[model samples]
Target: MLFTYPIAATADNWVSTTLLELLKNAVEYLQNAQEPDGFQESVPEEYQAEFARGTKFPDLYAAFVDQCRLLNDQQRDLVLKALAGQNGFPGLFAANTPCPNITVTLQAVNQATRSLFEYAFGKLSDLKTPGSVDTVRARYHQLVHSHIASGCCPFCGLEILEAPDPDLVDPDLDHYLAISKYPFAGANLRNLTAMGTTCNRSYKGAKDILLNELNQKVDCIDPYGDQLITISLAGTVLLPGGGQGPAWVLSFDPDALSQNWRRIFKLETRLQANVLEKQYQTWLESCVKYAQKNGIDISLKEGAIEAVRKFRDTCEYETFPAIARLKTNFFELVEAELNDPQDGDRMHNFVAAVQAA
Candidate 1:
């Protein structure tokens, strides 16, 4: 996938200033709700009484607030560091800091944070009101549609343009670190990212991106970081039973994290869908049409290579980048065949047959 710009740097602009103010207010509210022995009283009376009643988990709220209060300045800084997409904080917190002895589960803290996040941002319907604060979901939708993604899902490079509704059009925000697992980072800006709903809800549901099998934090490529993932077509083979010309196998460099990313998103399998194959076939047909219109004889090796190169270059900035990369790599394979003296004649004949078809 193409690299993503830093989200933390840009997130502040989209998030309403009122939301930050509300967060500070919520913190104060939590602090006031706590008693001397780390138990909470009922919530403030200003909120709707029924809503306030639901929030009154005295011990759980107290434990969550106490955990935050117990953090030293350095540890607090680490919290901010994790929010900025840096590594080391998760592991440090898990290993060094022990949860206080209270009836609070980490899941409770996560749920509380999520509730606070929603309250501060307001509801989705509230976002349409003139001066109401923008919800986190709304801000993330804006970030995805206007900045990171356009006509398709950025993570899978699939054209998800079937719906016209803004909510349906916009991709889902997958918490890169599962919010259920990392409660402290639930509202951290950098942890949120736009992904296809299928990838987020179906394939990568609640999976931990930061932690390893040993439960130690291992660094994965943050989509918001400067690192770029390169997807290429590894090879193609004609399958005896398939109707299509050949099945292309895609590969990625920097395989460690890239492979993990692929597995998490099910990218290879997603890209191999019948619709995508049809799209690829259509793209190939366009190249042949262009060659014919320009009076270029693609029956020759050099001519076929030139036509493929032109098509590949044209697709570089298109909406579906995965297709562009695949096409580029496919052309490179053709170029290799043309350069080999032994295979050159056979490759030329293959092109002639494709052109005639």
Candidate 2:
């Protein structure tokens, strides 16, 4: 939720709008059907639209309606209406918001709509013209690369963010409100953005952020919205769980949003492995070098004590956000330890660790 990329700032993507138009047409036809099974295999000439110049939108929407054939007239209409709305993403994702509680009777509709949208999603990348500069994918790449300046993923700030490279791998376009759980948002770019492979696969995969498995609901911060989080060292503990040297206590702003974000991404656990464990010793070594370069004398206990402030002063100021976040919390912990008489054990431990390196 601390992610800074603004999805709301971006205009409606033309390609997404075009795909959405097809979805609207398909859903409207089903909603207007005189009976649940009255629809034809293909649409009428006027209702047909080309997804791209040569690719037909296909005779697929009727197949989804077929899945819902056992449903009554009112149930069928409820299912179709669920598929038609896409503009609710912004409000639905905002803090304290709850998705409409569709009952189990509408389950067939949910499955059918999800299937239809995902089928459409497969063609999104091809919605562009050959070598056309004025295309949605090109614009998406430009905006993403520009806004995600550190090249770090907004989801966890733990990996590089890049546009799709033909010779290499492409980043996953993650739906903030995952399509598996929500009916209306599968193709909406407002509900979608780039995500790191680890964040997408290992952490937030197919999990319903809005309503967990226990059926509890909470509002999640929009990845593209302005509600941002900051990292800080709340405190440090010596011999955490009676085994470790030290461990970080992290916090985020706007208390309401942090809980769900933390839960979904497992921020603390991953940051510990990827950032803290990996970087702690290197940061300590850098502090020692800083002390040596600045001629901060550390020959005696008091002299070594004098170097804590200088050590804390040299935390890395890099473009990578996770590194920057680590430095902020790590150095603050070091300074706080040195300032406390009760924390002399950690203070001396830090001095020994850095100076030894």
TM, every model:
0.66, 0.81
Q: What's the CA error at residue 82 for candidate 2, in Å?
A: 2.3
Worst 10 residues of 1 by lDDT: 95-104
RMSD of each: 7.1, 4.3
Number of backbone-clashing residue pairs for each candidate, in the order shown: 0, 1
Q: List the global CA lDDT of all models.
A: 0.54, 0.63
**CA lDDT, candidate 2, residue 229:** 83
Clashing pairs in 1: none
Candidate 1 regions exceeding 4 Å error are: 5-10, 13-136, 149-151, 160-170, 212-217, 234-249, 273-282
RMSD to native, candidate 1: 7.1
Q: What is candidate 1's lDDT per residue for 71-105, written digit by digit as tens?
A: 44554343333323322333332423332211133
Q: Which stretches of candidate 2 lie over 4 Å from their true place?
A: 8-12, 18-56, 65-71, 84-87, 94-96, 101-104, 129-135, 163-166, 238-244, 300-316, 341-349
Best by TM-score: 2
Q: Model 2: clashing residue pairs?
A: 7-224
